[model samples]
Target chain A: MSGATSRATTARDAHRTAHVVGRVLGVGVSLGVLVIVVGLVLMLLRHPGYTTGQVPLHALIGRHARFPVGIEGLVRALRHGSAAGVVLLGVVVILASPIVGAIVAAGGFLAARDLRIGVIALVVVLILLVATVAL
Target chain B: MPITPLLFILVLVLVAAVAGLLGSLVGLGGGVIVVPVLTLVFHVDIRLAVGASLVTVIATSATGASRLLRRDLVHLRLALFLAVATTLGAITGALVSRHVPTRVLFVLFAAVLGYSAVAMLRRRPEAAPRAGHSDAVANALGLNASAPVGEGGQVVHFEVRRSILGLVAMYGAGVVSALLGIGSGALNVPTMDVLMGVPLKVASATSSFMIGLTAAASAAIYLSRGQIDPLIAAPIAIGVLGGATLGARLLTSVNAVVVQRLFIVVLAVVAIEMLQKGFA
Candidate 1:
C-alpha cells in the first residue's frame, strides 16, 4: 500500500490496518447470522408446522423468547447446542459487536498515539456496557 | 385471517429485503420501512415490531460496513463522538418508551419522518470544506477525514460546527431509534450534512457505520425487557443483510436523487397513515 494511494492522514490511517474495524464488525455479525441460519433450518425441520402454520401477529411476537442475559446467559447458551440455545447464541453475538468494535478502535487509536480519540472510544465502550448491563 | 409462522417468515423476508434495498440506496437503515409495515400491515405491537426491526438494522449495517469501512468512506472519529451521545439517549429512550403514550409517540415519530422526507427532496450540497487545515477541536479529535473521489483521494476539510447541537440531535436520533426501532438516519445524515458540513457520501457512510453501534446499545435494553423475538428477527436479519449487500453495490451506479425522491414519497405516505393510526 503506497502512501500516495490515499491523500490525507485522517481517521482512516489512525489504525495500522484501515480494514481492521471492518473485519472485526463483519466477523462478529456474520458469525451470528450464520448461527441464525442454522437454527432456522433446524427449526423448520424439527417443526414442519412453521413452514405453513400461521399465528396472530400479537400472539406470534408479543412475547419475547426465553433467552438468558449477560455473561451467564452467554455461557449457558453456548454450552447447549439445542435449537433454542443456538438462536440465543446468535442474538448474543449480535449484541456484543459494538462493545467489541469500541475495544478494537480504542486499542488502535492508543497504538497510533492518538490519546484523544482513544479516550473517546473508551468512553463509548463504557457507556455501551452500562446500557447493556444496567438496562 | 391469522398468519401462519411459515407464511409470516416469508412475508417478513420479502418486506425486509425491499426495505434493505431502498435503505441502502438512500443511505438509511431498512428499519424505517420495516417498523411501519410490521405494525400496520402485520398488526404487531409497536414494541415487538421495533424489536424485530432493530435486529434487521444491525444486520443491514454490518453487511455494508464490511465494505464501506475499508473504502475510507467512514469517518470513525465523527461516528464515535456521536455514538457517545446517541448511546446514552438510546438507554433513556428504552427506559421511557413504555411510559410514552403510544398516540403521542406516533405523532412525534410522524413529525420526524415528515421532516426527513422534505430534507431528502432538497438538492445535494457542495463538497466539504477544503482539506488539510483542521480547526482546533477537529484536529484534536482527529475528525478531519478523506474519501477516494475521482482519481485520488480528496481530503475532506470539515469543521464540526454547532458541536453541542450536533450531539443533542444525535441524542434525539438515538432516542428515536430506540423508541421507534428505526435506524434514525432521518436525523443523523441531515445533522452531519446541514450542521457539520460533511460531504454527502461521507455523512451517509458515517451514519451507516454508527447504525450498528447505536442499535447494539439499544438492542440490549430490548433484550433485557424480553421484547426481541428471535424467530421474528432472524429471518428478517438474513433478508436485510442480503438486500443491503446488493443495494450497496448498486449505489454508485444508481441515480441517487431519483431514488431519494421516490423514498420521500413512500415515507410521506407512511407518515400520514401512522398519524391517522395514532389519532384512531
Candidate 2:
C-alpha cells in the first residue's frame, strides 16, 4: 500500500478503536450512575428520617460506620437487599469501566494488527488487574 | 445550621459538580476541590474524603474521556502506553505510602506543583508540527495524530517527541497521585505538553483519559481496604459524572489558552494547599 493509503488505514483503525472504547465508557458510566441514583432514592425511602433527622454526614463516612468492603462484602450486601449494597455495586461498576475499556482497546489494537500497542495495552490490563487483587 | 444527612449530601453533590466541571476541563480528577471540601467543610474524615475523591476522579475521567474520544482528542495509543508505567507506579506508591513520611512527600510535591505552575505560565502554546516529524520511538508507537479544533473543522496534526521521557515522568506522576491521594494531572499535562510535544488541548484530554486507569489501580486498593464509603462515593460519582460530561462537551470548543490558564490556577491552589497540609 502507498504511504498515504497506509496512513489512512491507520487513522481509520484508530477511529474505530476510539469509537468502540468511547461507547464502552459512556455506557458503563451512564448505567453505573443510574444505578447509584436509584440506590440513593432507595436509601431515602428506607430511612425517611434522613431528610429530617440531625444525622451528621460523619455517621456514614466515619471510622465506625458499618458498610460493606471488597467484592465478597458487596455480594453479601446485595444478597441481603441492602440499599448501601446497591450503591456499592454502582461504585464497583464505575471503577470497572476503565478496566473494561482498556481490555476493549487492547483487543481493538490486536485486531488492527498493531502488535506493539496491543501488547502494551494487554500489559496495562494485567498491571491493573494485579493492582486490584494484590495491592 | 444543623443540616440533615440528606441535605448534607445534596450540598456535597453540588460541590462535587463544580469540582468535576473544573477538573474535567483541566484533565484533573477533581480531587483538588473534593478532598478539601469534604474534609474541611463537611468535616468528614480525611481517609473517607480521599477515598471519595479517588472515586470521583475515575468518574471524571470516564465521563470526560468518553466525550473526548468521540472528538478524536484523546491519543489512545499514547494513553495506553503511558498507563503501563503509571499503573505499576501507582501500586508501588500504594504499597510504599504506609512507610513514607507523608509530610515530607507533601512538601516535595508542593514544590513540584509550584514549579510546574510557573513553567506552564512561561511556556507559549506550540504549533502543531507536520506529520512524520516524530522520533523513532514515537514513530514506532504511531503516537502522532490530528485533533479537530473549534467548529471550523480545522485539524491540528502534532508529533510526539521524547516519549520515553514522557513515560518516565508519567510513572512519577502516578506515584505522586497515589502518595498524595490526588489525581496527578498537574504533572501529566506538563509532561505530555512539554516533554512529549503534544498540543495543550490534546495533552489535557489524553491525560484525562489516562487518569481513570491510573486512579482505578489505587481505588481498588482503597475499596478492598474499606476506605470507600458508598454513601459518599455514590453522590460524588453521580455529580462528577454529570459535571465531567458537560465539561468534556465544552472543552473542544473552548480556547486552549483559557484551559491552560484555568489549569495553572488550579495547580497554584493545590500547591498552596499541599504546603499548608505539610506544615499542619
Candidate 3:
C-alpha cells in the first residue's frame, strides 16, 4: 500500500509539472510569434517598396551588413521603433523560452521534493546559462 | 524567377513548415532541411543559414515538446539528466570546431548515421511495457516514466536502462551537433531508443524536448555574432512553431511503426547528405 501510494504521488507530481511546463511553452511561442508577425507587417507597411526589391540575401550577409545584434543593439533598435528591433525582440523571447522552461521545471521538481531530479535540473540550468553567457 | 523579398519570405516559410513538421515528428530539429534550403535555394550565407536553422530548431522543440509534455510522452527527468552532458559537450565542440577538419568529421558522422539506421531497422518495436524490468541507476534517478500508448487513455509504464550509456551518447550527439551545425537528433533518438531501451515514442518526444536546450547554447553565440538576420529568422520561427504544433498533435495518433519507418528514411537521407558534404 505504501509503494502504490508513493507511485501515485510521483505520477501526480509529474503530471502537474508537465502541465505547467506545457503552458509556459505554449504561451512563450504564441507571444513571440505574434510579435514577429506584427513586426513584419509594420515593416512592410512602413516600406512599401520592400516587396519591390529583389531578395538581398547576399547583401544582407555581407561584411558591411548592418543590423542589430546582442542585447544592447536590440534595445537601441527598439528605442528607435525599428521593425527589425521588434522582430529581434520576438526572436529573443523565442530563444529564452526553453531556458525559462528549464528554470520552471527545476523549481517544480524542487518544490515536489524530488531532490535527485531537482538537483539534476538545477545543474542543467547552470550549464545552459554558462553556455549562453560564456560560449 | 524574380525572387523579391516578399516572395523569398513566403517560400522560406512554406519550406520551413514542412521541415518543422518532419523534424517535430522525429525530434531532428529540422536544421537539416532549413540549412540546405536557405543556403542552396535562397543563396543565404552558411553562417546566416545556421543561425536561422538554430531558431527553427528551438521553435520546433518548444512547440512540439510542449504538446508532447501535455500528453505525458516526454520523460522530463530523463531529459534533464542527459542535458547536462549534452550541453557541456556542445560547448566543448564549439570550442574545438575550428581545430578539427570538417571533411573528416562529416564522413565519420555519416558512418555513424548509417550504422544507426541499420541498427534501428533490425530492432523490433516494443509491443507493451515490460513488467518488473528495473534498473538501479534509473530507479535512483527517477528516470522511469509512463506514456499513454493507445485509445481510452491506456497508459504503459516503461523503464529506463543503461542511463549512464545514454548520457555518454548524448554527450557525443551534442559534440556532433555543434561541429556540424546540425541538431543530431538522429543520434539522440537512437541513443535513447536503441541503446537505452526507451520506447520510440518516448525517445522521440524526449529528444524533441532536449534538442532545444542544445540549440539554445549555440544560438546565443550566433545571436551575439550577428549571424541571425531578423528578416530571415522571423518567418522561419513563426512557420516552424505552427508546423511543430501540428506535428506534435499528429504524433500522438500516429502508429509507432510508421514513425519508426519515417525516422529510418530520415537517417538514410541525412547520411547521404553528410557523405556528399564529406567528399565534395
Candidate 4:
C-alpha cells in the first residue's frame, strides 16, 4: 500500500478503536449506576415507612393500563403522587447516573491527549447532571 | 398465583434485552416492540406504558448518539434545529392529545404507519450521496465541513428546505412519540433519508441522536403530571441502555436489509392491530 493510503487507513482504524473504547467505558458506567439504583431500592424497601405493595410491578402496570383520569384527578391524588414522584425521580437519577458518567468518561478518554475536547465533554455532562438534579 | 416482584423485574429485563437487541439491529431501537408488549402482554396502562416507552427512547438515543456523533453520522446543527421545532410541536401535540379522544390518536398513528410503510418501500436501499451541495451550502447549513466522508468522497450536502420539512416531520414524530411511546424512528428515518436526502445509516443514527432531546421535551410534562413511575422507568431505562449497547455491537454482523424488512412487516401488523382497536 502507498504511504498516504496506509496512513489514512491507520487514522480511520484509530478513530474506530477510540470510538469503541468510549462506548464500552460508557456501558461500564451504566452498569455501575444500575447497581447503585438496586441498592437504593433495597434500602428504601427496608425503611419503616415504605412497604411492598400487594401487586407486583408488572401486575400493577397491567391492571392500570387505561388512560389516567386526568390532571384534576391526579391533582386530587397529588399528596401521595408527589411523594412517589420524588422517590421515583431519585431512582431514575441513580439508575441513569452511570450511563451519563460513562459517556463523559469515554469522551475524556478519547480526548486524553487533547485537553479541549476532553474538558468540554466532561464539563458539559457535569453541568447537565447538576442541572438535572437542581431542577 | 401472582408473579413476584422479582419475576416482574425479570420480565422487564427480558423485554429490555430483546428490545435493545432488536432495536439496535433494525434501527427502530425496539421502543415500538416494547410498547405493544407492555400494553398487550403485561397489560400496563397505555398512558404509563407510553411513558415508560419514552424513557426507553431516551436510552436508545443516549446509547447511539455518542458513537454516531464520533462517526459524524449525527448532524448536530440539524438536530438542534429539529429539537427546537419538535419540542414546540410536542407541547402542542401533548395538550391536544389530552383533550382528543384516545381513538383519534390511534387513528392518527395508523395513518402515520401507513405513510411510513409506503415511504419505506420507496426509500433507496443503498444511500446515494446527493449532488450539487457546494461548500457555501454546507457552511450555511452549519454542517461540519472539516470531516468530509472518506478521501475523494463527495461531501454530503443537504437542502435547507427539505431539512425544514424533516423537522416538521419530526414535530409530528414528537407528537407520535408522546402519544405512542415509541421512538419516532419509523417517522424520522424516512423524513431524513427519503425527504432530506441523508444517507440511510446517517438518517437512522441521527434519528437515534434526536430521540433523547425529543423525549426530554415531553418527559418533563409527564413528570410534572405524576405519570412517571421511578420504579418502572428505572429498570426499563437500565435494561434498554444495556440492551442497546449490545444491539449496536450486534449490528456489525447482522443482515440489515433482512432485519429492516422484517421490522417493516412487524410494524405493519402492529399498525393494523392499532387500527382495529381504534375503529372497533
Candidate 5:
C-alpha cells in the first residue's frame, strides 16, 4: 500500500475502534444508571419515611446513616442486595467507566501498533489509577 | 427547605436533568447549574452540594462524550494530550484558590469568556492557521483528523493548529474549573474550536472527554472524604446521564452555527452571573 493508503487504513481502523469504545462506555454508564434507578425504587418502597413526609434532608443524612465506604464496602453491599448498597455500587461502577475506557484504549492502541498513543494511554490509566488509589 | 422527602428527591432529579441538558449543549459538566440549585434552592450544605454536583458533572461528561465518540466527533488523541496540561493546572489552581482574590479572578474569567463569545459569533473560518508554526507542528504530531459532515457520507478532514495556544487555554480552563467550581467546558470548546481550529462539534466532544478525566480527580477526593451521600449523588447522576445522552443526540442533528450560537449564549449568561456574584 502507498503511504497515504496505509495512513487512511489506520485511521479507518481507529475509527471503528472508537465506535466500539464509545458503545462500551455507553453500556457501562447505562448499566450504572439502571442499577441506581432500581436501588432508588426499592428505597422508596422500603422506607416508610419517604411516603410519610419524614426523612427530611434524606439524602444528606438518612442515606448516610447506612452508607457504604470504599470499594470493598460497595461490593459487600451489592452482595447483600441492600438498596443503599446497590446505589453505592452504581456510583462505583460509574466512577470506574472512564478508567475502563482508558485501559481499553491503551489496549486498542497497542493492537494498532500505535506505540506513542499506546504509551500515552497507559500513562493516562496510571494517572487515573493513582488518583483513585490516593484518595 | 422543609419540603416532603419524596418531593425533594423528585425535584432534585428534575433540576439535575435540566442542568445536564444545558451543560452538555454548551460543553459543560452541568455542575454550574446543579451547585446553585442544591445550595441556594434546596438549602443543602455548600460542601454537600459541591460533592453531589461533582458527581453529577462526571455523569454529564461520561454520557455526553460517549455519544460523541460513537459519532466519530471526539478527538481522542487531542484530548489525551491536553489532559496533561489540564491536570497540572487543576493542582495549581486548587493550591492557590484559597489565597487568591477570586472576585478579581472572576472578573478576568468573565472577560475571557466574553472574548470567546465574540470569536464564536463572528462566523470566521474555523480551519485557518493561527501562526506560521501551526501547520508544521500539527503535521509533525499527526494531529490531523476527520469527521462526518451532516447526513452525507463524505467527511471533512482537518488538522489541529496552534496547540500551544490550546494547551494554554486548557490550562486556564482547568484552573477556572478548580477555582470557581464550574465545569471548564465553556472555555474548552472555544479554545479547541476557535483557537486550535478544531471543528465545533469535534471541539465540544473533546471537551466533554477532557471533563470526564479532570473531574474524576477531585471527584475521587470528594467521595473518599465521605462528602457524597449515595441518595443525592445517585439520583443526580442518573438524571445527568439521561440528559447528556439526549443533548449529545441533539448535537448531531443541529447545525454547527446553531451550536456555536448556543455556546455563546451559555457563556454570556454564565459570565454575567459570575460577575454579578463577584460584585455582590
Candidate 6:
C-alpha cells in the first residue's frame, strides 16, 4: 500500500513539472513572436516604397522608426532625418510602453488578486521597454 | 555595404555587458564605459558616440527597473510624482543641450562626478524616520498630484519634502544624461537614497526606472540629429540586459563596501578624463 502511494505521488509531481515547463515555453514563445511581429510591422511601415515625400520614416512616424528595426533601412533613415517630429514620436513611445506594461501587469494582478506579483510584472515590463529602446 | 555586416554588434555587446556588470556593481551605467571605448577603441564619431551612449543609458535603466519593480522595491507613488518633474526637467535639459558648448557640457559633467564622489564619501546620519504617505506633505510636494499607482506589499511610508529634492536632483541628472550620454545613476541613486531617506534598494530601483524615460526624452533630440547608430545601440542593449541579469545574481548577499570604494576611484578617473575633454 505504501509503495503504491509513493508511485502515485511521483506521477503527480512529474505532471506538475511538465505543466510548468509548458507554461515557461509558452511565455517565451509568445514574447519571441511579439518581438518578431513588431519588427516586421515596423519594417513594413518604414519601407523605402512607403515614403509620403522626402519625409522618410523618421519624418513621417517618429524617432521610433529608427530604433534599429532589426533591419538596416529604418536605422539609416532615423540617423538621417532632420525634423523635431522624430523626438516627439520617440517621447510618445517612451512614455507609452511603461503604461502598457503597468496596465497588463495590473490586469494580471486583478485576475489573480496577487498585488505583489502584479507590481513585479509592472516593473519588469517597464524595464523591458527601456531595454528595447536603448537597444 | 551589406549593412556594415553588423561588425560592431559583438564588440558593442561585450562592451555593454561589461558596462552593465560594473554599473550594477559600482552603481554607474555603461555610458561611462561605452563613450570612451566607442570614440577611442571603436573609432566611432564623438557625436555618434554620445548619441548611442544616451540611448544605452535608457536601456540600462529599463532593464534594471523591471527587475526591481518585480520585487516591489520601487516606491511607485513617489516615483510617479517625481517623474512628472523629472520629465519636464529632462525635456528642458535636452533643449538646453543644444545651446551649451560640448566643452562646457564636459565641465558640467565633471562637476556632477565630483559631487557624486563627495556624496559617497559622506555618511548619512541616522535620523528620525518619516512616513511615506503623508497626505498633507505629499500634496504640498506635488506627490499627491501625481498619477496614483497601486503596488502590493507592505505600504512603506517616507517623507515627501525630501523626495521633491530628489526630483530636483534628477533634473540635474537628466541634463547630464542628455548632454553626455552617461546615465545619471551616480547622481540619481545618491539623491534618492541619501537625501530623500529612501532605502538603498528602492533608491537604486527607482533611479533605474527613471533613467530610461529621461534618456528616451533626450534621445529624441539626438535621433532628430541623425546620430543614433542602430548597429551600436542594438548590441549594447541586448548585451547589457544579459550582463545585468548575471551581475544582479552575483550581487546578492555580497559586501557592498568594497564595491563602493572601487566606484569612487573609477569616478575620479572618469572625472579627470572629462576635465581633459573640457580643456581639449
Best-fitting candidate, scored by TM-score: 1
lDDT of 3 by residue, B41-128 (tens): 6657656776777777777778778888887788888888889888877777766755667567667657766876786677665455
Question: Over the stretch B231-266, how does candidate 2's per-residue lDDT look in tens digits?
Answer: 988888777767776876888887868877987887
- Candidate 4 chain A TM is 0.31
**Which has the better TM-score: candidate 3, or candidate 6?**
3
Evaluated on chain B only, what are the TM-scores of all the candidate structures, in order?
0.90, 0.81, 0.78, 0.84, 0.75, 0.79
lDDT tens digits, residue span A23-58, model 1: 888898889988888877776777666565643344
Q: How well does candidate 4 score on lDDT at residue A108?
A: 40
Docking class of 1: acceptable
Best by lDDT: 2
Model 4: per-residue Cα lDDT over B1-280, one tens digit each:
6655555666787787777776677666666767666655765656666667666676567666766766656554445446555555555554555677767766766666666666666655554545434333333433322224433654544443355566578888877777766667777777766666666666676677667656655655665554555555656766777777787788879888787787678778878976886787
By TM-score, how accurate is candidate 6? Answer: 0.63
Residue pairs with colliding backbones in model 3 are none
Q: Give per-residue CA lDDT, model 1, range B1-280, as digits (tens).
A: 5677777778888888888899888766788788788778877778877887887887777667657778767777788888998888888888899898878767876887787788777746555453333345665565655455423564534555566678899998899888888788768887887777677777777888788888888888887776777777777887788888889789899998899889999999999988998999
What ranges in model 2 sit over 4 Å off?
A1-9, A54-56, B24-28, B101-123, B130-133, B146-157, B246-274
Q: Which fraction of the native contacts appears in each prediction?
A: 0.50, 0.74, 0.63, 0.09, 0.40, 0.01
| Candidate 3 chain A weakest lDDT stretch, 10 residues | A1-10
- Where model 5 places Cα greater than 4 Å from the true spot, the runs are A1-9, A58-66, A72-82, B24-29, B88-140, B149-154, B179-181, B246-280
The better candidate by TM-score, 2 or 5, is: 2
lDDT of 4 at B140: 42
Candidates sorted by lDDT, descending order? 2, 3, 1, 5, 4, 6
| DockQ scores of all models, one per candidate | 0.44, 0.58, 0.53, 0.12, 0.39, 0.04
List runs of model 6 lying over 4 Å from the truth. A1-96, A99-135, B1-7, B121-156, B162-167, B253-258
lDDT of each: 0.75, 0.79, 0.75, 0.56, 0.68, 0.54
Scored by lDDT, model 4 comes in at 0.56
